[model samples]
Target: MSEKKGSLSINSENIFPIIKKWLYSDHDIFFRELVSNGCDAITKLKKLEMMGEAEIADDEEFKIQILANPKEKTLTFIDNGLGMTADEVDEYINQIAFSGAEAFLEQYKDKTSEDQIIGHFGLGFYSAFMVADRVTIETLSYKKDAKAVLWDCEDGMDFTMSDSDKADRGTKITLYLNDDSVEFANIFKAKEILDKYCSFMPVEIFVSDPSAEPEYQTIMEEELTDKDTVIEHIVEPAKTEEKEKEDGTKETVEVEPEKKKVKILKRPVSISDTTPLWTKHPNECTEEEYREFYHKVFLDYKEPLFWIHLNMDYPFNLKGILYFPKINTEYESIEGTIKLYNNQVFIADNIKEVIPEFLMLLKGVIDCPDLPLNVSRSALQNDGFVKKISDYITKKVADKLSGMCKTDKEEYEKYWDDISPFIKFGCLKDTKFCEKMSDYVLFKNLDDKYLTFKECLEENKDKHENTIFYTNDPVQQSQYVNMFKAEGIDAVVLKDAIDQPFISQLEQKNENVKFVRIDADLNDSFTEEISEDELKDATEKLTETFKKALNRDQLDVKVQKIKDEKVSSMITVSEESRRMQDMMKMYGMSGMDPAMFGGSGETLVLNANNALVKYILANPEGENTDIMCKQLYDLAVISHTPLNPESMTAFIERSNKILEILSEK
Candidate 1:
């Protein structure tokens, strides 16, 4: 046949501008598009063979090969599946065979594009123009006597087709990489793009580069076992008389019908695991296999604390394994790798709709064949299926955690430390997850014991009254922790930064629950009996002396007779007021006094039963008394917060003078 050429039929004269303008910024996508086209051709042929419409030669293996050469700056995708003829190319390119072209243009007419279905539309084959100056297609149709054809398109508009000697059934697309996209011609880059886009494609894909080690194709295999039909020949003694009629009944003949045996065939290497663990029944999988799969998917050396296997076909086809990894980086974003796939083909990583924002901290794989993707296939379209899938995932994770906590006490406690942040974050973000995981959420106390909110409430209901005492800083608030221990009460530790927001969330979730930081206030149990009327005069006198000595405008003072005389005094703050002040400071709001932090804008409780307070009451107006008042206030301030340089110097001077006086006596 003679060569023919003409402008491409489209709404616009050139498709490159459309692809370049609103399509994307990633230039390497062309490789994925072209490779996907090759896979599609293979798929069409496989479907034909399965339906008995065509016969694939046993010797002809269905495979996709990538040949990249940097020296020539050209990349070629070769497939041995199905090819095309010149007439077919013209028909396909004109927008009849490739259905996605018109739809894609319409979809992207306004919306910015994504990575999904870049190749789904017939335009995926044309994406080559984004990186290549010229692209050539040398293919031989699968017809018994179809001729080979060569089609060339340079400007992405005009193309020519002619006869060629490209002997093979499938297509071979060759891209002459432009100077700007020469990186795509690099062997490593080509291999990487194939690995990213075609890894899970349902075909045997091999990356072939001349520079490859030993000039071999890079082939990887994922095992998915199934029984194959094997033809078997059997021989047995026949039911003699009827079968041997022609041989005159004397001699018995053997007759047996051939039967097909279900045999397991040797699996070949492929780019992806066609059947992932999520695709199987949970009963069919074991703990060790799940752990190994987790390692392969996440590449994390640590075994996950637990995993939730999700498989549902009803509301929507949803299957995945969500793992609760052992989180150690409290300061870092708890962003986990949740790879989303559609029919085993990877779409994107950690898609928000499929994997909720809170579940992003989990490492897992979700493959939903019926997932709805908009024109670009970039993100999941908001639909009922998406909502159902997300709700199912959240429920599955909660069920797994709650089950483990109830069935395995030792294991639950063992993993509580590593998984607490994840559960807490999930509870804070998702109301339903919070509701389900509430019973399993745990906090560690000063006694090195883990307890849930229900357990905490049960133990402290009589005295603390649903108030959970927690310490944000164990070492800094060691004194307070010791007092709580002395009172035989356990104070939970909330040292991690996430623990702060988590505490607030816990309080918000339950009306009766309150998480009070150890230093946030003085519990009512720690307050001693007070004689307000009898000690009013002395309390006022002491409050006045400390105000003058500390040079403060106002001093909210109190006198309490406590049992533990070792603790001379402590500055107390209302939990509500302190939390408000912390909230204001955290937001960097100014105009608040720095000195207020020492007092938390609250009161200072003086232990009137202590020897020091007794001595101060007796010698309320002397110079010694003045120095002692300053020393006591300074001690409380230092314990409340680190002192300023000026305050520390004055406190030291006052202490030295008092020591000298005592020594002289």
Candidate 2:
């Protein structure tokens, strides 16, 4: 064969620029594309071997070796898979977007399914140009007596092919790192990219630095297995230790029974897990394996509360594990990574089109071989099939939760606090998920007991009747919580940021149900009936006194005779108005005045049964009457919510003055 040179079979002159600059926005993904192409080549060879068209040794190992040479500024991907001849390279390499895997599948369509082929677009090889100034391919076909072919292309448009003395059986792609992409040629960077995209690929992957000395690890002879390639064996001398004899005398003796031999091996670790936990059957996976995989993949040391293993084949080939990680801090955002994969090749993280927006809060991996990916595989193509996959994932999550609630109520309750945010977010985003999980939703009460919506509604039915009470901050609202407890009333805790909107969504779905904050109102159980005339008189007097002392004529003041005598005054805001304020704050409009969006609808409830109310009524014009009124207002406001800086400062000053008066006494 003679050397041949020609222009690449590209449709337009601007194609190379489009492929390098505009196609893949993320440059690091070039590693994934090239590695995945190597994997496909290996898979095609295996398929050929299985069909008896090719012969392979029983002990032969197929792997993809990534060599990063920083000094030479070149990145290489070598695969011991099906290679191509000169003619094959001319047909596949020179063509743009003509997938060799697709062509192989077409030729062997009757023998194998397309599930194992990772490359749909032959352009995956051209992705090398994304970070390379020059790309070269050296391949020796699996066919007998096939001459090795060397193909090189500079600027990704013009190419040269010639006969080569290569001895390898598979393709080797070398990328001369451009000035801007020199970082990729570093061994550490190469390993990082491999770990990110090829961690769970079907074929084993190893990264190495050719310029660096070979790394060796010593392993005990007993620990050495078939997978290891031992370089040499060394025997260690037995150690001696002082031992206590049966007669209570110390004696020097050999601790080890015999000398131990250890084997030294090079490159003992593979970068990718050929069979990830997600690819296995759920019945075959153990709790420990799930936990280990979670720690390894997500790098989250905190144990996940639970996980959902998704395995399906008929409707669409999908396999994954969704982990509900235990939230370490309440203030931390619930955002998590949902790595999307196509046949074990990672596409991106948190792809909403395939992962379902709500599932983005879960740390997991979903590999759907049937995913419709665009040329770059960075984004999902708009297709109804993708929606089916998304819906399938949501259904699986809902099924897991609802099933747990039915059969494992105790364990379900234990994980409710950690996983409730995800479930609630799902309920808000997915209608089908909400419908399935509606009955399984658990609400933790003030006593830390978990209860469903029905249980909560039933427990409060006799007293509050259809009104559901909840508290956001149990510590800040302890006063209200204790009052509710004393009155034999119950309220669930909704502390997560998502709870407010979630509860609103719940209300919208269940029109008859209502959610009110613990501090939103004074329940009827906390008060006793009083004569209408006496109540009216007390209300009028307290309103006038507070209105004058606070210097606000329009202040809403109500006097109620409460059972708890220790209670002085408390503030209450209408549920609607409080929700409005919360919405404003969530949208970053908290700085706006409440008056601008209508009044806060707040009212001061003065407990008539308390000694402070009696003293104020008896000494309306007393020397300390105005001081007592202002102090009561501040205390009520403080108990209800945090005071603004100006109000808090005034409250502290007033407190200090009162303390001074007491000291003088």
- Best lDDT among the predictions, by candidate number: 2
Q: Put down candidate 2 lDDT per residue, 345-443, tens digits, no spaces.
A: 988889878888988988999999988786677666646898998899998998888999999899898888888888898889889998999899999
Off by over 4 Å in 1: 96-120, 211-301, 329-331, 500-509, 590-600, 619-631, 637-665
TM for every model, in the order presented, reads 0.82, 0.90
Q: Please state the error at residue 215 of candidate 2 in Å.
A: 3.6
- Which digits, one per residue and each the tens of the lDDT, describe model 1 over residues 99-207? 6556655555555545444444545576677888888989998877889989888866777888989876888889998888888878778777767766666666766
- In terms of lDDT, model 2 sits at 0.86
Q: After superposition, how far is residue 340 of candidate 2 from its true place, in Å?
A: 1.4
Scored by CA lDDT, what does every candidate get?
0.75, 0.86
Task: Judging by TM-score against the true structure, name the best candidate.
Answer: 2
After best superposition, candidate 2 residue 351: deviation in angstroms? 1.0
